[model samples]
Target: MQFENTLEFAQRLDKQDTLNSYRDHFLFPKVNEKQVIYFTGNSLGLQPKNAKKYVDEVMQDWEELAVEGHFYADKPWWDYHERLANPLSKIIGAKPSEITVMNTLTVNLHLLMVSFYRPKGKRYKIICEEKAFPSDQYMLQSQVRFHGYDPNDAIVEIKKRDGEHNFRIEDILDTITEVGEECALILIGGVNYYTGQVFDMKTITKAGHDIGAFVGWDLAHAAGNIKLELHDWDVDFASWCSYKYMNSGPGNASGCFIHERFHNQTEIPRFEGWWGTSRETRFLMKPQFEPMPNADAWQLSNAPILALAPYLASLELFDEVGMDALIKKRNLIVAYLEYILKEIDAQVESTFEIITPSNPKERGTQLSVFLHGEGKKLFEFLMKNGVITDWREPNVIRLAPAPFYCSFEDMFRFGQILKQGILEKNSELSS
Candidate 1:
């Protein structure tokens, strides 16, 4: 799709968008009773219009059936989480047996670590990117200390080279090769949370497995935003929250995946609970823990039917639109945003630099912009004027134009707002 050099081009793209009607499916925030151009889906997606109905169904089940709802509601609360597996699996590119929707993201991360982070005598190290999200860093540190290992010695962080904005894939591979023998697991985000850079999961998984190490991904920023093939990539395990691009509400339940190879491996120890017990004997009140023999065995408690309903609604939409269509739309929209931003930068004196990669395959929906002089003030100005984007620490402002709901016109308007902010800064100094 060639974008013309006029605002009409963006309007035309919006008209031509196949998923344009999906915008009305979401409830965007309004200022003065008008919809705001929301670009913060990377942080909190706009709520779906049908979210209330989804929640109401579960509420009705609870009201009508009470305790009986677990066994025999319309959807059967006992197996509520299972109904999500097929659709969630399609979003993450995995089989039904390899995925399960359950606990929150950090909680699920800990559970997966308990089962995967088996640190043997000599090989007791973990490798992750240096600027990983704080929650992940804390979890990794606590896990290492819990096993009586010093995080300073046991954790290896791959950092960007000097004067570089992002880490090179080859450097990551080299780190794995150099420390492969000592590393027990490679747990990194599928997309770097701060930089908006997407890593090559297949290559990373292959490198880790070549050295007898487990590979997992924190897909918090990747799932539903990018096209993933976790099963094809042979990723050993992965976890992600649904609130972001999935458009589930904040603090929504998370999803986890375990490759089919581990389906029957009873030797691996997990922190088990009654909910993960075999379905056939769960009611027998048995003394021993007979796990459910799949990824569901990692589940810890009864499914939160209320929390899982929003995901069901969102995943159904994803199934209808499909990832291929979303990704194609995303590439064009993101490239348009990048092209306009570069044009503005060139017109000015190179005041803003895009930290995210220019290549569409290397990023999903977000573009992290680094302003030269005054980033925070500009961000605050945009927020007060109703252009919604996220500000990371120091100098980065992240804007994600979600393909499912955002329009090319939104990107065009964002460029105008950004240019106005920069020009305003110049005028204030001169005045």
Candidate 2:
């Protein structure tokens, strides 16, 4: 598909977009009076209009039923989180029983690791990328130290080659083989937050399993953004937050996937609670912890109804428009964004570099632009000009044209504003 760097071309594309109706479903922040160009959905997605109604429904249940809401209210609170499992299963490509909506991403990471990261004797090292998300880094470090191993020795970080923006898949495979004997677990982001590189989870999972190591993913950015088949890929465990691409809201509940192979195996250890016990036996007040035969056995506590309402609202959209539809729009729009950004890079005196993988298969909607000369200042310029993007450390602007809400015209306008900001900065330098 050819792309032209013109407003008319963008408008034409928008007119033809099948998912264009979804844009009206979300609430965007305003700049002056008009809507801002929101490219920060990779950080916090815009609220769905139905979110309020969902929350109110939950609130109404609480108000009317009080404690009876657990069993007899509309949408029983006892089974609230389960409502998300089926819809979420569709998005992540897993068996409904293999998925559960629960705590936040990092908390679920810790919980999943409790069962998966069983380091015995010499097979104690954890393999991960050098630049994992800070939460993952901290969790890995603490987990390694908790098992009485030096973090530097027990944690193997796969590094990219010098001056490269992302890690090579071959290098990742080689590292897995090299550390196969000593490695206990392999954990990595499905889509890297900074570079937006999507790892080949299927190949990585096979490589890790071949080496007698468990493989897990922190799918904070990948869960809803990319097409995932965690069960078919044989991903041992994975977790993701709902606020970002899932468009739940700020600090909403997250989802977890534990392969069915791990289910019904009480031999595997987990930090258990009453909620994890079988629903039939839970009311009996049995001191013994007989875990559920599914992924819900990992739940430490009952559902947080208020926190989950928005997530359920959002997942309904995901279930309505499957990943195939979202990815179709995602690739074309992202390509258009790439084309326009490259055009800006070519035309501007002060330039930016897109650090994300060029191949759509290796990325999602995110495009990380590493600004050279006066780029940090340009971030502020973009914000003041009503472009809602994210600024990373040093000088990278992470922009995600989220498929649900962002339009082709938004990409064109963003490019024009970014060029304007760069040109103005260059002029300031000259004067």
Candidate 3:
């Protein structure tokens, strides 16, 4: 599809968009008294207008029903988390019984490690990608240290080739094989946060299982942004934050996928809590902990109704539109964005290096661009001009044109803003 850098071209794409009307469902922030062109959905998603209604329902339940709201409310507070399972299952390609809403992402990872990361003798090392998200890095380091091993020895990082931004699948498989006997766990981010590169999870999971290692994924960025088949991929376990592309509120509840094969395995150690017990026996005050037959066995406490409310609201949108539709729009919009970037680069003769994979299969909503010749100042200019985006250290700016709320017009407008920012920076220097 040939893309032209013109307003009419962008508007035509918008008109043809089936999900274009859904953009009105979100609440955008105003900058300079106008709605900002949001590009940071990879970090925090725009709030759904219905999110307020969901939260209000929960609040009213608590207000009027009191403690009895646990069983009497419209959604029933006690089993409210269960409502998310079916829709979420569709999004991540897992059975409803295999998925659960639980603690935050890193916390869930730590809790899941209690069951999956069993290290003994030589098979004690954990294999992960180099430069993982800092939270993951800290979690791995702390977990290994807790198990009485130096992190430098216990964590095996698969490094990218020098001068390359993305890790090769061959290098990853080779690392897993080389660390074969020693690798106890293989956990990697399904979509790399920094480079916006989507790892080959199914192949990587197979490689990890070929050896004697439990494999898992941190799907923080991949959860709603990419197509995932956690169940069919035979992933041992996985966790993700709901705030980013999932469009839940900030720091909301997380989603977990534990393959059904592990459901009734009582021998697998987990940090049991009040909610982990069977629901029928929960009110009985039984001393014995009888775990649920599903993924709810991992729940340590009661669900956070406020957080889950927004998440359920967001999931309704996902269910209505479906992932297939989202991905279709995502591919075209991202391609259009890339074209606009290249066209702007040619027009301005500015060096803007997009480090993300050009292959649509290897990326999601994000584009991490290295802003050469224009750095912090250009980022500031965009911010002032109502182009809300993300900035990493040094010069790379991350722009995630989320398909739900972001339009093709946003892409064209961003290009114009980017070009203006660069030219303005040059003018200041020349003056």
Best model per lDDT: 3
List the lowest-lDDT window of 10 residues for candidate 1. Answer: 342-351
lDDT tens readout by residue for model 3, 1-431: 88999999999999999999999999999999989999999999999999999999999999999999999999999999999999999999999999999999999999999999999999999999999999999999999999999999999999999999999999999999999999999999999999899999999999999998999999999999999999999999999999999999889899999999999888898999978889989989898899999999999899999899999999999999999999999999999999999999998857889999999999999999998877798899999999999899888999999999999999999999989988877788789
Sort the candidates on TM-score, descending order: 3, 2, 1
Which one wins on TM-score? 3
* Model 2 pairs whose backbones collide: none
**Count of backbone collisions in candidate 3:** 0
Cα lDDT of model 1 by residue, 1-431, tens digit: 56654689999988989999999899888755666778899988888888888899899988998999888888898889998889888889999999988889999999999989999988999999987999999999999999999999999999899988988999999999999789999999999988899999999999999998999999999999998999999999999999999999999999999999988777787888888899999989899988887899999899998999888988888989999999989898889988888778876654788899888889999999998876588898888667888888889899899998898888887778777888898888889
Ranking by lDDT: 3, 2, 1
lDDT of each: 0.90, 0.92, 0.95
On the 0 to 100 scale, the lDDT of residue 240 in model 2 is 96
Compose the digit string of candidate 2's lDDT tens values, residues 1-431.
88999999999999999999999999999987879999998999999999999999988988898998899977898998988999989888899999998889999999999999999988999999988999999999999999899999999999999999999999999999999789999999999999899999999999999999999999999988999999999999999999999999899898999999999998888999999999999999899999999999999898899999999999889989999999999999999999998899899876678999998889998999888765567999999989999889888989899999999999999999989998888787889
TM-score of each: 0.98, 0.99, 0.99
Clashes (candidate 2): 0
Worst 10 residues of 3 by lDDT: 421-430
Candidate 2's C-alpha runs over 4 A off are none
